[model samples]
Target: MKALIIAATAAASLVSTAALAQQAAPQNPGPVIPGVCTYYNARLLAQSSAGQAVETRMQQLAQEVQGELQPYATAIQTEATALQSGGASIPADQLNQRRQALQQRAQEAQQLEATRENELRYTLGTQRQKITEAVSPILTALYQEKGCGLLLDRESVFMMNPAMDLTDVAIQRLNAALPTLTFNRMPVPAQ
Candidate 1:
């Protein structure tokens, strides 16, 4: 009886394993309307060729800014170290002057940082606008080509079928149309 029960348990386990193995993986649902409506994923902009170029350019600009500021930082650090080590030996008036000069240098460095940040922000915004301008016509052409009567921004939707996504096609078209974008640190206009 014990042997028979063990054999039955083994058979049952094998049968369950076989059933699980036969089950199919979940498939993506098709679009509700094959061509009448589609969605564009705006978040996918970063994956496009132009977007990549912008990112690379931004990195280069950031590195340049760091290089430009490094000397100012080193000078400030050197003066600060000198003041900290020998401030007691200096005459009162001279010490005060040195402290004030150090403070002024720090303030200047801060101002330069703010200015560079503003320039970087301006450059980023302008580059994004250029990319948007380039993408707009491509999206329009895709809408027409797909016979889509309704176009939805992916951000605005709650849920969507994979078939309705046009982001990949849009990126492909964008790569073929505008491969790379060139941009510079746009000077921030005086407020």
Candidate 2:
């Protein structure tokens, strides 16, 4: 009847309005912001300076470790020479004992070297963490000040216009904000 047709039309109109309302809802545009993308490699800066300091420290530590092991090295060499020569007249048990002692000493040296390596690695990791922590705030400040949207690693970039290279500015700002080289000589723990 007429009522049934009117009801059908009203339902259709409500459905159409619901569809339109759904379509009209706002949607995210995906990271929309007005800013330039700049490449920044924080590790490169930390490594460049800290690497030199680590190398110097390692060299000194190596010399000290070597000096400590010099006597053991000489003793091992002497025992091996004795085994090779007529000193073989020495008892087999004694010879085996000497050889085992030499092996143990070598093993000790290896362990010491490993320990030093671990220490160096720990130092490097800690230093890098410290530098990153210190630089993060600086980078944030710069990013906010400049209204930068994204900061990418320089290494990841294939090619970019010179205008996109804010690395130099970042580096300069970081270096200027950092304490002097002498101050960086000490190891900094993670914050």
Q: State the C-alpha lDDT per candidate.
A: 0.74, 0.56
Q: Which tens-of-lDDT digit does each residue in 98-162 have in candidate 2?
A: 77887887888777655555554455456556556656786787778778878766556544454
Model 2: per-residue Cα lDDT at residue 122: 57
| Model 2, runs deviating above 4 Å | 1-34, 42-78, 85-87, 180-191
How many collisions per candidate? 0, 0
What would the per-residue lDDT of candidate 1 be over residues 12-53, giving only the tens digit for each residue? 564454345435313655446856555444433566888778
Best by TM-score: 1
| Cα TM-score per model | 0.77, 0.62
